[model samples]
Target: MTDQTDGGRRLSTQEAARVLGVKPATVYAYVSRGQLTSRRDPAGRGSSFDAAEVADLARRSRREAAAPAGGELSVRTALTLIEPDRYYLRGVDAVALASRYRYEEVAEWLWTGKLAPGAVFTAPPEALAAAGRAVAALPEHSGPIDRLRVAVAAAAVADPLRFDLSEEAVLGSARCLIPTLVGALPEKAAPSWPGDGRISRRLWSRLTAREPDPDALAVLDLALSLLVDHDLAASTLAVRVAASARAHPYAAVSAGLGALEGPLHGAAGRLAHRMLREVLEQGSAAPVVAEYLRAGRRVPGLGHRLYRAEDPRATALFARLEELPHAAPALTAAREVATTMARQRDLHPNVDLALAVLTVSSDMPPESGETIFAISRTAGWIAHALEEYQAPPLRMRPTGHYEGPTPPQPLP
Candidate 1:
């Protein structure tokens, strides 16, 4: 058994097969049957079972050589990698990766099978000009995300080649849309040398306001990388469902953004931001937090569905924030509030809370909070769309139960 500390390493089925003196196909069968545990590699290949877990499985199998009636098994479409507990991309901890790389680069890696490669740097002038028009068309009061949503949809429409979700078209759209969403015409492109190893981090910094103080942009880049994908989150599920209708990536992703815009999925950032604003405006983070507890309102960005301890992504962001030069009084206040709230209510900060503080600390425009989340999430949306396109069709159909006495007197 490998030590528990070998967190990211994996042995191939061929290698494990040699260890077990079995065929490689048999090893792969062990994985599909869940009799062996394995993980995806950086190249998207699922390497063979964990030595420790596989040993355990072998032990149990040997002990129970002939039994079949103890437990039931079922086939599942959740094979889409939607399980919250173990979901990841290329063995990179999704949450950990979010805090480890840049937003643009993360999207690129997930889509085109490369990490931090240079964007197809020469977007047609027409594309940029069309994006500018989309920008101009937005109401001045609309926030960055709203503008992005509109612009992306517009770009897809204007392209006329959008239905071509051929591998080439999908990849190109992803590359162009990534930058366009992060920054419009005037936003500076980060100084990433093509194929530069740190291009993802550099691009992340570019998305921040012109003068981000604590290097929150860097922290955000890492966070985005981790969060950029989750197997089939509700919004991602929406994208997949829409894709089952033969929707292209753009159409699918647009549907995803709509689902994300809902409160339960996309609006956590806004919730946290509003809570923090109330705390700052009222001169105390306590009463506001306490009232929420008293009212049973969900404390925005505290608990997470997958993480039980502190969310690793939140921990990573907070750790890097200590050295930020652009720290605000409210950011400090919010942290203290977070600490106090934790002790007082046993609640801890979640990703949204951390990001809310970051947005405030960055002096970003108010709407920028949701905008950033959506922007980071675009990668996930696109990824889910691609996955759906590759998957078997129409599995999302829901069955309806007959009710109300079989439609009553309709036959009369």
Candidate 2:
């Protein structure tokens, strides 16, 4: 094939692919991502790409090695951008949104491209009854998140039209889902939700036995919004992988919960919460911090993969904690623990620390942080499931190269 030049040296898709030492699809991906400049064919037959840009991209792609953990799998997502210190959810500043918006509002924005004004979400009475039965039927010692898992399963069973994958249908389910999940937690008294029935208000009633205060409730709200999503986390990936199998949205969220059961992901805050409680009870963080370090265990909630400095979410939550008079002891203990970690190990606290502090300050259940994380992440799981549903099914299958002993020849 003859190469074509339009003013500058331009290459057709095939020629550009050859120059870049990549496939035609990769060339298109580069063009779509704006890594390569392309224009319509002057002859109106095929597309033309800038040869110089193609060459430059080729050089850069060659120098870049595959990321160690991901096996060189490149996933293109427009949902979240994770930087060293901050992240954006669909181009909105996530930290700022956490402070300025309600959890449900942010969840709607994440699920749908546009935020709907005057949106209100209420759980269906029967679905709530189903979820409540599921939660109450569990063992008395069942954790908050366990109740949530059962509730999700029950909700899915109750929804007859859950197989529908249309945007309107999925969003409709999610609108009820948040409330149903929150309502499923065992109520401490009559009318478990005493406030305006916002998710934050309902969630507070579920997690704590004590009455709610505005300061504590504000912290929980911010915590939920901040934890709503991070790009391709382990749990989020699990959700996407499930959705790629064409699983219903509820099933996809269940998959996310399964992955989040691990300590490294969802339960990290529980560990931090325990340690913070120890500090508050002992009236000093020095011995607890020293013992944790001496055991050669990295302090949980002190570091994160995506931030070199302090986590922006943690910073925002910690700032809000300063205004609560009742949280003074817990806040001081958290501050001491953070200062000790930073001074001794040069590591900064992540959002888990702030979450633990919030739980302790509000006198919520010790496992409440994990529950908040799971609930907040449900929005992200649903959003990812929606995105995956639009793609070809089972697209996330991974092939493994043989590294074991060769098998015997087949008996013919």
Candidate 3:
């Protein structure tokens, strides 16, 4: 017995092959591929393998073979890398960037690969007017995302050079497009604070009728920064597909906005908001949370597929909110929900729960979080679009395997 074989006895090649249900050659192949670790005996015996690694790999292999499409297939991306519990944007710590930098800064970094301190984000007045008109033309019950889609379309029509897919031209278009989208949404009042012209404050005005608190404004900015890009999210993938076809930046972002409307993606924030509101109104989380569990319903904002530990983005935002007095109640409710879910199912809250808490605690509209998600994700979409434009056209097409009924005869 050795102390290093996952705290148990190591196995020789023959024994390991037996446990793995494979021949000795297969065991050596596993070692060659780095799937199993093997150590040589000090007394000149043959290589010994870690039993636990062999067992784990056997289980994983079976599960993967039985799984359907989209099972841990690696897609090469230089934009973002998602690790066990945290994500990096172009090799930068996203959580660190969110905490210290504004959304504008993060966007610049993602789109241009540099965070210029003196960089400016400005929208053309004519485009802003066009966005306003487009938003006003929508139905009264339309959500912010609907307005965003209309605004992008309008911007596309207004910009004659929108077809220029060059990087320089695309960067200019994206910078104008983001603020214009924010400006197009309904705002209760004009910028009242000193730096109210900033997109975060402008967006804050549009999201709520209340006076903008500095702390809340900071949280909103951080939220935007945190969400700017998340590898290849559903929305980002949609944007990339469009861009691969040489679609304009506006059209690419529109594709992303369309995917963002799906419930399992960007719109998850609204569902989470509803659940948290119920908890806040009832004065306790147990009853409402328990009812969802008993009914076999998925508890929104409770779990994430990519993160095994606490979501770093959620943690960063919650830590910021802890310093703000006004966010206490909402934070408390979020904690209760988190604790309850972990106790019951051992699941952790993801970025959605953090977003819900931000909106509810700060008294933003129910749809505010989704709006933030769309706007922030716009930066990511554009980054992906830029990347895709340089790739071979139509390279993402997958060949379909025919599983339908066989033909009776050949064109009789």
lDDT of each: 0.62, 0.83, 0.83
Q: Per-prediction TM-score, please?
A: 0.70, 0.82, 0.80
- Candidate 1 lDDT over residue span 1-412, tens digit each: 2223356444666667655544566577667776787775655665645676655655554333233234321112222243334445655555554555456656766775567643332344566567768888777666555666676776676577778756677767776666665444234445433333242333444345454333654666665665676655777778778866768777777787788777788788777877877887888877887898899887787877775556666677677776675656556766766776678566667777777777666655455567666766777777666655543345445445567675556775
Model 3, residue 12: what's the lDDT? 84
lDDT of 2 by residue, 357-410 (tens): 888887777788988998899989899988777544566766678987678857
For model 2, the local distance difference test gives: 0.83
Candidate 3, residues 288-389, lDDT tens digits: the string is 899988999888887777888878889998898898887788889888988988875878888888999889887877898899999899988998988777
Please provide the root mean square deviation of candidate 3 (C-alpha atoms, Å).
Answer: 13.3
Q: Measured by TM-score, how close is model 1 to the native structure? A: 0.70
Question: Which runs in model 3 stand beyond 4 Å of their true positions?
Answer: 1-74, 194-196, 408-412
